[model samples]
Target chain A: MASLYLIGIGPGSMDNLTGLAVKKLNESSVIIGYKYYINLIRPILKNKEIIESEITNEVDRAERAVLEVLNGKTVSLVSSGDSGIYGMAGLALEIISKKNIDIDVHVIPGISALNSAAALLGSPIMNDFCSISLSTNLTPWNIIEKRIMNAAEADFVIIFYNPKSMRRQNGIVNAMEIIKRYRNESTPVGIVKNAYRDGQEVILTDIKSMDYNTIDMFSTVIIGNSQTYLYKDFMITPRGYSKKYEY
Target chain B: MASLYLIGIGPGSMDNLTGLAVKKLNESSVIIGYKYYINLIRPILKNKEIIESEITNEVDRAERAVLEVLNGKTVSLVSSGDSGIYGMAGLALEIISKKNIDIDVHVIPGISALNSAAALLGSPIMNDFCSISLSTNLTPWNIIEKRIMNAAEADFVIIFYNPKSMRRQNGIVNAMEIIKRYRNESTPVGIVKNAYRDGQEVILTDIKSMDYNTIDMFSTVIIGNSQTYLYKDFMITPRGYSKKYEY
Candidate 1:
């Protein structure tokens, strides 16, 4: 049986890549990933045949990767972030299962951008949180709106992925308005720009006090729940732990 | 002013670590982390001093790392998972802020255990999810129960970290019972043993069908929400996409 490795390269860091992922990348003759993501790993790839695609062309990459793996060459498909989190792992598995190529598919997990971005800012994710991508690529805005409302109603910490681009800069404002409909305006908000990257910047603000215009495509916004507090300049979402609670 | 780097190592992988994190790691001369995590990257240390500790010793590690960084050495205190997710980034900040360290604190983001365990289990974490660590070291069970209730009520995809050990083998069963209070028995559950490492196994079961006695310390379990489905040997927590409104 032929084999395929669906590798998660993490949030663009070489060391954060697992030993297994690196071994697969080195052993596999063919590598498939988004062109931008491919560019990030070109320096590390050792004489591998790379297949790069655009962002919206996930199915094409999966198809090509499966075909390449079926040809009896150790082929590896790469995905930026955890791949399971809004990345190409699911789509690849779907296509692979559909093809039924007697291939042993291996998935090596990596860090998602949200966790990386959240780490860049303090403990904004220490509470019960939900991650919602603002892009309407797969789900409808109404359902997205309802999820946002449910998040707001439940006072769950909210992590907004794919926050904005030139065409959809207004979606974040709409999300904030909906959140404010149920949550307090003083709820803490954390914006991580290019988190875990060269030009990283972290901003801690509030829902009502946010300057929406400052955010962009590379930024991820983490809005804290009602009980989240800002202590010693850190955005802390208390897990409700401490010695005082031990009765 | 001296600075301390609170770096999230992201599941014992170098390539899975971020470029920004690598930059900070490169700058630091003293490294502090669990002995195993430090040993994972021993080749890259290049003669850097390491203060390795056991995984459970948090406050002591933070104090020692802070002291090293305060003494004019650039110290890198590493944590598995995102640094702030039950990690040392916050605890370090809390200690340093009180000591007047006049230090620059940088948190380098890494891959978290939730995403790693999820990716190992095929498409298990595709929808709304919350992560709860059953290690009640400092966190109380009452708050953990509330989070479980909230997750069950929201029908969120739930990932249980540190699920079972020799002493705490019943954590998942207790959590499942709490979840069953709000969720049904048919919800899909996935358990990934030894996630992101050698000898990893992914188990696909459900709330009513799972056996807790078989799990060990290395296992991380995930429970799918109401809309979750299993198709072609892959678990999917559909985000309510692929179904459009009839206008």
Candidate 2:
């Protein structure tokens, strides 16, 4: 159909790629993505026109992918996690809409970092949860702070993405301070670096004992709700089944 | 090493299953899940001991799967979506912890209904988001209301699961009223039923114009944030990319 397939490659592991994602990648004539993400799925990107760009060139990559679809080429635009969540799907769709281009677009869902990280650290996000990206590259720090505060106040299990970068280091620290106002210092936090990928590291710590040095741009940090607790090496959040059932 | 694999089958579509999930399912001697979810993946259940339970028997299914693993059988306990989120992973892990079972447990992530629904609805959850289950069977209604109000007040994109059932129907209506206090009545809301599966339905409507009749337990409803907008047949939430870069 000469469509633009916005595919999420899942985490870094090829084994985590959904069967639908693999089929779409096979059907795509060209692949477009950030250079790091492109490398993650390079094993399956054979005989395709691979378009790699810098991490900051999201708009350029999105525009190029849409233009390729306009040129009657089946294009696959890849994102590291779920394409629709903090990924390229919105940008590409926005570009197509603003340009008033008529084209077929398929948004393929994937196992996002939230799902991947949660599984690795037992089940810390078993109940109501909210995800806030700490990257101020696009969103204002104030808005991010408000989200952290409100999510904490609501007692929602919170996940922090892009917690720390080389240039911006205090986002997580500031965020934890705001969360502490609503939660206790003993709240369990699960941190996964390079989830399901090479050099993958999983750590279970509390709010007071979390080591910021272990976190980076690639890490996903999960702060549990009031009910969350650490048992052995796994962080567990009961989905309130105990209140209803005898489990 | 008879490990218990808690696997997410990814919203009733075999094509959405991850490679690792397939591998684990093939490796297992027994498969346990709800009857509906087990039927969804019947093609892959060949030569395996199948254990299907009613929808309300999650703890039973989890306990049975754990018992099978304890009896030296590799068991795959399947969930329709990501197991860690409103699924069987937490329950199984909790049971194991409480019983002090020394068994290998591997949790495999999958494309959850949230991820699948967001993709079908076209990027409605690109920004910060929270998911709240509307069912009061396990959680108190007051707690659910508090989450809805706080998520809305925080301006996080909200995803509603278990929106409606035969016995309880006013959850979505009451939730909308609370959200209306914080958001405009015209806020974009996307609804997807049986996402990526047979009888799949995707509707793009606004807060004031939503059709509650189309929603059921199988439906996932997404209410957009302030920045979300409707264009063509798709609902989109900009990742605030326009504020930093021109598109």
Candidate 3:
């Protein structure tokens, strides 16, 4: 049966691609993705037919993939990070359901930015954590702020995706202010830019000293919980081992 | 430089192993992990010296891995999910730091169970979400309950890791009661057991009708926020796209 495979390429590097993801991509007859993501996987795309579209045209891209699948072509819709998390899988499934299209949609998970950033920044997410996208394009700023405030109050290791953009100048700063309401000023903050890609940068700072000027859409920001601390250059949150077991 | 590598072998299947993780496992001279996890990766451990320990002996396993690295042997400490999240990375680093062992530590991230579960259950985590483990072995029950309540009140999609075990029977039931105080009883809940492995089961039901009997340590439970719904056997949470764009 022909199917539409939603594959996450995992930080845009072939090294991070899972063996299942690579096999599905190779088996796909056609590939569809945002223009930037398409270029990121160009090295492995070989002879597959590629369809590039604008980032804003997610619905259109999803509809096109479903249409191709219905036409008996194996389609691979690519996205960075896990396709199920803030990626193309949701939109594609919505389109298929609305159109009543008969097709098999397989969502293949990958290493999201949260995973890559957490690895670089030690174990900040070793415990409970929440992730909220700071981009207000699709979600309202007020809703985003409320989520951040609640997560902060709960002392979750908070992760902010798409922290800053060209038009949205004050999102990260505003988020930090809300976070400071419940967290200490010295809480560890990890900023990872272009993770697992070229020009990758990992910065460790405190909530009070975080430099938002260097953050952009390509970065993922993590604010550690109250228990998080820095040992040498590594930012770590103990997984309750110190309290439960003696070293 | 001799290094200790912490690798997450995603879902304990060779297919889900990333290319980088596979390379590191192959390059390492010694591999160490929990007894169950070591058995899961037996196919790839043809030539490497394998060391297995009981699940309760995480500190002992971590210390042994660090000792091997200090003795100039390349070692890989394997974990089932993203190693930085509830894995051996933090314990090993803590041991190395305390013992004043000078060795390079590299954490290779993989697809966590949450990611794999979300993919199988559709995109229930497409929006803002948080994950909390139900195990109270290390964390106090009060703290765990508070985090679940706050996440529920904030309407963040909640993922529960280690939802149940033989000894702890009432954790999931207690968690569901707290969540019901904030969310509607009809809220979507997805239970994925042994995701991407043998005997995998995906169940989509409502909060009022969830069956805890089928859940175990290998399962991941996702309780969707107020906005999540089930459409054609797929549990989905909108990414605020329907409100932002006309589809």
Candidate 4:
């Protein structure tokens, strides 16, 4: 049986790659992913056939991976974070189902940007947290706005992926405004750029004074809940231990 | 400077260990964790001094790690999932902060159970999602209930960690009831037990007919949002590619 592996190579760093991910990538004959992701793993793709495509051609990339698998090539479709979360796994499965392709698909989980960012910024996500992507390319801005509003109202430690981009300037600022209505302007916000990768920058700022200019498409923004606080230089969200456990 | 490492050994399996994690563990002079988690990493703790403690003694275990570090021993405090997310990272940091301990603490992120569960059940968490631990040990039930309600109301996919236990049998049931108020009873729900570990099990069912008997403390349950759907044996939440792009 032909196998198509959807592998998440965490945060574009060799240090973050799991042993299983490295083994599977080594075993795969062909690697398919966006040009940036492909180049990120170029050091490991010594003899493997590489298939690169533009970022906008996600469906096409998924279809190509499925086609490669159907053609009897063991293919690995790569994504930056956990492939099941806003990655290539969904698209590949959808393509396979749509075309009635029979192939063994396995999703190899990897550390997500949220996990990497949370570790770098201390434990801001120690309790209930929700992730919202601010990109308005696939999802409408109105829908994104509603999610941010409800998440804020719910007091969820909100993590924003794709928070800002070159063309979409006001997306994150608008989302922050919605969050401000529910959370205090003094709520701690942690912004991480290129987590675990080169040129990494981690900043702990309040929601009101957050510098939008520092955030880019490569950055992840986390808006702390009402209970989150800053401890020294680290952002800490108490896991109700002080309230429940008398330590 | 004495070093204390807080490591997340993903899903309690050697296969999921990252290269960096393995290196750090090998370098540590002592391994400290809960009994269950310590046993999970026993295979790699050949020469390291093992300090196993009961599950209820989280603060004690963290303090012990700090004490070991203070004694000039490189200590590795291991957790099952991402250490920063409801794991030992916050507890260890709190202990250090309270005591004003000056030790170099490094948190190594790992593949969380939520990531493993999402991969096994298809891409049910491709969009915005929230994780809430149902255990009321450290957090009040009212807070957990409110988070569940808000997550469901916002239509964010909900992942419940530590969903059920022998004494707390009604936690998940109560959580589902809160979700039912916002989402339909027929919404897709995924239950994964021992994800990526021995005796792994994955079940996909709807919110109305989900079998509570099958869930336990080891299980991670994911309740899909309004946009989630089931295709064949797989659960999927689209990232809005089909609605936005024509491939």
Q: Can you write out model 2's per-residue Cα lDDT over A1-247, one digit (the tens) per residue? A: 6999999999979999999999999999999999999999999989999999999899999999988998999999999999998989999988888888899998999889999999999999889999999999989999999999889988999999899998999999999999989999999999999999999999999999999999999999999999999988899999877777786
Candidate 3 local lDDT, residue A64: 89
lDDT for position B14 in model 4: 86
On lDDT, the leading prediction is 2
TM-score of each: 0.85, 0.99, 0.98, 0.97
* Arranged by TM-score, best first: 2, 3, 4, 1
Cα RMSDs, all models: 3.9, 0.8, 1.0, 1.3
Candidate 2, residue B231: the lDDT equals: 87
Q: After superposition, how far is residue A155 of candidate 3 from its true place, in Å?
A: 0.9
At residue A149, what lDDT does model 2 achieve?
Answer: 89
lDDT head-to-head 1 vs 2, winner: 2
Candidate with top TM-score is 2
Docking quality tier of candidate 3? Answer: high
Q: Mind giving the per-residue lDDT tens digits that candidate 2 earns over B1-247?
A: 9999999999988899999999999999999999999999999889999999999898899999998998999999999899999999999999988888899998999899899999999999899999999988889999999999889988999999999998899999999999999999999999999998899999999999998898998999999999999988899999888787787
Question: Clash pairs of candidate 4?
Answer: none
TM-score of model 4 vs. true structure: 0.97
Residue pairs with backbone atoms closer than 3 Å in model 2 (clashes):
none
What tens digits encode model 1's per-residue C-alpha lDDT throughout B153-216?
A: 7666887877877677677788888988877788888887766566767788888899897578
Q: Tens digit of lDDT per residue, candidate 4, span A29-49?
A: 999999998888899898999
**Residue A174's C-alpha lDDT in candidate 3?**
92
Candidate scoring better on DockQ of 1 and 2: 2
